[model samples]
Target: MLSYARQTLKRVPSFQELLQGTMGSAKEEISVDVLVIGAGPTGLGAAKRLNQIDGPSWLIVDSNETPGGLASTDVTPEGFLYDVGGHVIFSHYKYFDDCIDEALPNEDDWYTHQRISYVRCKELWVPYPFQNNISMLPKEDQSRCVDSMIDAFVEARISATKPKDFDEWIVRNMGVGVADLFMRPYNYKVWAVPTTKWEQMQCAWLGERVAAPDVKKVITNVIHNKTAGGWGPNATFRFPARDGTGGIWIAVAKTLPKSNTRFGEHGAVTKIDADAHRATLKDGTVVKYQKMVNTMAVDSLVQHMGDKELVDLSKGLFYSSTHVIGVGIRGERPERIGDKCWLYFPEDNCPFYRATIFSNYSPYNQPQKDVKLPTQQLANGSKPSSSEAKEGPYWSIMVEVSESSMKPVDGKSLLADCIQGLVNTDMIKPTDEIVSTYHRRFDHGYPTPTLEREGVLKQLLPALQAKDIWSRGRFGSWRYEVGNQDHSFMLGVEAADNIVNGAVELTLNYPDFVNGRQNTERRLVEGAQVFAKSKKSVD
Candidate 1:
């Protein structure tokens, strides 16, 4: 690569002439057909598809030492694993499944989970699809909810026009009582923005992701004192049996040739010179490419390029930072927890919006029962009576706290607050020994689907694409509805298709179209016409 750079420099001596009076060492340069930034699932997907086609010379890179970007997991000193937030494998595409299956082919590599989940409401656990399970609420609350739901049904029968914003949609579909009691507070806690205020979120991003209550069925359930069945894409999901969520991407990255990937300090991209189609890494290696697939947050990418117009447009995009807090308890798994996978907290009683039993996902997620560990502190913040290490069958819980301008958190006290909240909600006993605690803050967490997002993306994306850059991923596309692991991965796949063969970027442009049905166009098999090798016609 260094020799190539020297030869290129010799061929074009303008760089040498300009640096005649300056002290500088020649930087190594490498070339590829596609330069992929960020070795997350999205970047991996692009590289995987490119490799499958055998047409593009591509290199995937990330600043992190590991491959999983936001979807990655971290481990505590005590051996507990925590994902960035709640994450489970629920696919909307066959290609995504094929790639994941390729990565972890063994049945033992994963544990399929039946979604044992609930919402904490009025100091009671309500089966989720909280709107469908209002039967569990106190009688008075149920009465109000049913009355408003009946009103919403009547309104739905008469109303023709669509809801303008997420707030209105919530009220129109779930009724004012459901909105006020659960939807409003839960969304606020998750998005860190009010659904009805100036920062009101848009509703188009929701493509059947949120369940609309079946009014008559819900009423019947209420009358019969029953709970609704599980709903949505994640009703039954899977998790890695060994590492946490991050393990999947790491395994996927291994499928790609190591020579094609750069990670850690070497992969940290410092600048992107779009005019020259070059990306400069932190190690001073310049990677020149015919096309680029950028998986970093689009807002950050625009600022890195120093494009004033794009930066100005990117400012309209909103996001919330996530603080993931984990607590490892030194005890047997409590019966109250049962097989519960994740639980949601909507009220102010907890700083976290949701909590997952990380230990429940897999036995390896926490240390083995024989692994002894000393208590860091009690759940109630008091010193443990015994500081000596102890052995136990242990369980762990991971909680997520959202922070933004509208909903700021006390960073220093957030972990403590979350632990105390567990006790308050009976998630953990006050005297439970916390053997491990982990806290991490990710700045670009949940991308907000604000009213202004479309206008900014319409302009910003095209401007970048004109320079042969395709920014697509969770934060890259900034559409939370299509921002899961599956969606993000397919975004890269579609971007590659557009770059190589000019296929329509369905995941990027037609989110609702893609989300409305199962997309089985491209499979890792013969006769999958959508993914066949094609001539490079986009240029």
Candidate 2:
């Protein structure tokens, strides 16, 4: 009986194909054990796990044909590739590491890089974790940061209270010098929220994430005119040897059952009837499922469901959009720009908060060293006389800008502004020939850890779960700390486990707990000997 049901279900037209059927042939319902929405890493993660278990009739659908979500990559007309931002592979989980390894198995499949990072201040490149490297700052700036650090240290030793806002937290830990110079301005640019509006709880993630300077060491280094070495967890990471970050997801998607996945315009979900366990696709087919995993932004999901209560609660969650801009140039890689992965921009010289030397990740990131293309214009907006399609080599850079109502951008001129900013920051030569460009706006980019965010998610998630719908993912849960690819993927994995078996999802509920330790035990198949078997089967 079960086998017959499974076979019949497979033959039934999908919600999408129903549109092509005759008027009377259009089905009123279709059924599956589980329906996963959004083909991003998180949704794919859920689908991947479901496939591994080989349990329950499951199907995954996404609006876009491609995968990767924000971690995806884009290519320029000139053949340059740029990721959404700077997506480096640095995982805290063996499971995630193993999964990526499985996707791109060969040594040539990856590029291991030592992070060459920097901060721009007063036209000088300072080592990151600006608070810890105050010795490199100008004498006056150093004095200010050092004095503030001492005061903060003394105050913390005696004071019985904790800081309340992000600004106070910065001053308490980094001192006024670092705060005034780097912390305050830089964070505002990146977060699109004033430090005053940010809560101190957000600082909990910054310890290992940000490098703190030792005053004595910094002073000594400054006196000796010495620069600090690389700091932070991602001082080294892996990148795909080919394609951009998106290649990893695309490859991972290939490992899944093709029949279980749906994409393109037909995949767009118009409405979801939670009570009926039904989802209406763009083509007017209804899909009924026993369980649903939604990866769309929670706020958007609420709107799609037309649930008044969920929508109201979701309003408490807030996020800022991201603008990714890529530029490919005609020339050899610059000498001054040697081996830098990404750089931070805090000053007003540029609207972008960060810039990655996209070409530095791989040679294929740009057009073949020999591909010829006419120059659109120089970096400075000047038309070049060189109609010559001459290029033996090329390099590219990608930049990210945060936009919100609070921090509005001139969209019409944002690309031009970013190019000018690149020149101002010496990232590009004014007369450098520009070969290609790419720009895209993602509406629900970064979920802000606003003071109100936690309160809302606390209520919203449980409410959805009570209705048998699991809203999980980057914007789905709206927790920035757990919103990375690994975290988001695990959220789905754990969510599925919780629904299938009564398992406690440590990563989803307690991010700090999962993040605090090296999670080595979360693999689908364990043991070194089993790796070969697992690899062969997964491949």
Candidate 3:
């Protein structure tokens, strides 16, 4: 029944067929009122706000098939799960809480736990906020710390000017004893940059991050041989019960309209014509928009935009790289590691700055009890006695190693070095069975608040805003003070509001003001009435 003319006619291609590259031309064109790039907290926040308002046509795109940027989680082929690093839920805004609660709404959706943390020094576990628990140190060490504290207290009384750098700040506050013993080495490991390089960094973010020791209280505690309890807002935290932190973002993305979002390779932004307000995607699709909310790193954004001026302006910004390693061991949770949430390593015994008992956060963090996996090797570097696959209880530890041009790490031997470090630090027995291991590196990790940071951001932000492009995220703003999951989310929310209704970006402009207290005004369903129509105070 086939005719020659009928057989020659091509069928109309389906959307799925077009996406799969099965038929039709590869190029397309689209236009929207707002374009959001990178579906992390920042981009998602912008999209959420844009959806709330009915006026503008908007679309959000990300190169990644999934959301959650640096806040993402990953799983090993063996089923062991690990987050990019330590990510805990402690929010300043009700909108953030609302979004998370909306994503993970059921009572069984999360687990609430008290924070139990410690610092490893002198082969003894000392309560955190090490200066406040000098009592736990050896008697000679304790006396040395107290003497230095007294000297620092006296010096602080006579000093009139603010501490010039982080080193001086530490000495004036904690004295030489605590500074040399803990603050200096611990911070160096965490930042992968020396404290003496404080001129290239800032200490303003130290308020809640660092606990200032009270002279009288510290002395009294030392006299009584007491340990300090948990400190700061993260004293208690929550974790998603099923998938890791990535689950939160994925769930939140589900609440948004599918038509307004594009992910995967077709969504990758290849080139941005800031002048023409057009963005070319990898698949040769072009998107023209009135405004852009960019969540990608500022440096990356500049390179993509191909603006040499912006690229040169962003050179002053400095950052460190992060290496996240996870080790899955087949056994019951060790007695010494009982219920510890996270532990800080100041000594050289471990290459990692911190190790989190990731499995303790949720039973689902590792493979089910029934799944079987054979040991790759003994922690001591010995061959496994048995090659047969093994079943049963399992536990895992996640470690973070910081690196930069200042502090280099050997990528090839990193996993082996980390395992040996676990043994050297007494975190695992020499013969412990290691079932699975995971390693990932993020080039743009911690954004260092260099001495020149303020000057650079002042110029860069305004110049980009001139083109109707709002670069506003962790690296986008280059302000670590408001770079947590909660703050990053609000940055996008505020950016969208600014585009739509000329609202003030309180979180971006006034980090200290927003961080100092609870930000309850901005809710998902109910917009912030006060800041919604207020003009931005900062240019």
Question: How large is the C-alpha RMSD of every model relative to the true structure?
Answer: 5.5, 5.5, 6.9
C-alpha RMSD between model 1 and the true structure: 5.5
Badly placed stretches (over 4 Å) of model 2 are 1-28, 195-207, 517-539
Q: For candidate 3, lDDT tens digit of each residue in 1-539?
A: 00123233233333355567675455756667788998998999999988897577788999999988878899999998899989988877788898789888999999998989888998888988798999999999999899999898888999888887777788889999999899888888888897657566677766567787888889999999888777776788889998898888899899888767878887899999999999998989788777899999999999999999999999989999999999999999999999999999988878899999999999999998889999898988888999899896999999999998888999889888999988888899999999999999999989987778889999999889888889999998888888888889999998999888887788888776566633233343333453443434431
Candidate 1's error at 129, in angstroms?
A: 0.6
Question: Mind giving the per-residue lDDT tens digits that candidate 2 earns over 22-59?
Answer: 33344356677778998888888888877776446788
**Can you give the lDDT of residue 283 in candidate 2?**
62
lDDT of 3: 0.85
Q: Write the per-residue lDDT of candidate 1 for residues 1-539, one digit (tens) a residue.
A: 10112233221112233236232443657667788999888899888987786356778889999999989999988899899888999887789998999999999999999999999988899998799999999999999999999898889789988888888888889899998999999999999996547346889988757888988899899999999988877888999999989999999999987767888887899998888888998868788887899999998898778778888889899999999999999998899999999998889999999999999999999999999899989899999998899997899999999999888899999899999899989999998989999999999889988888899888888889989899999988888888889888988987887787776676787676566643233232322243233323332
Query: TM per model?
Result: 0.92, 0.91, 0.92
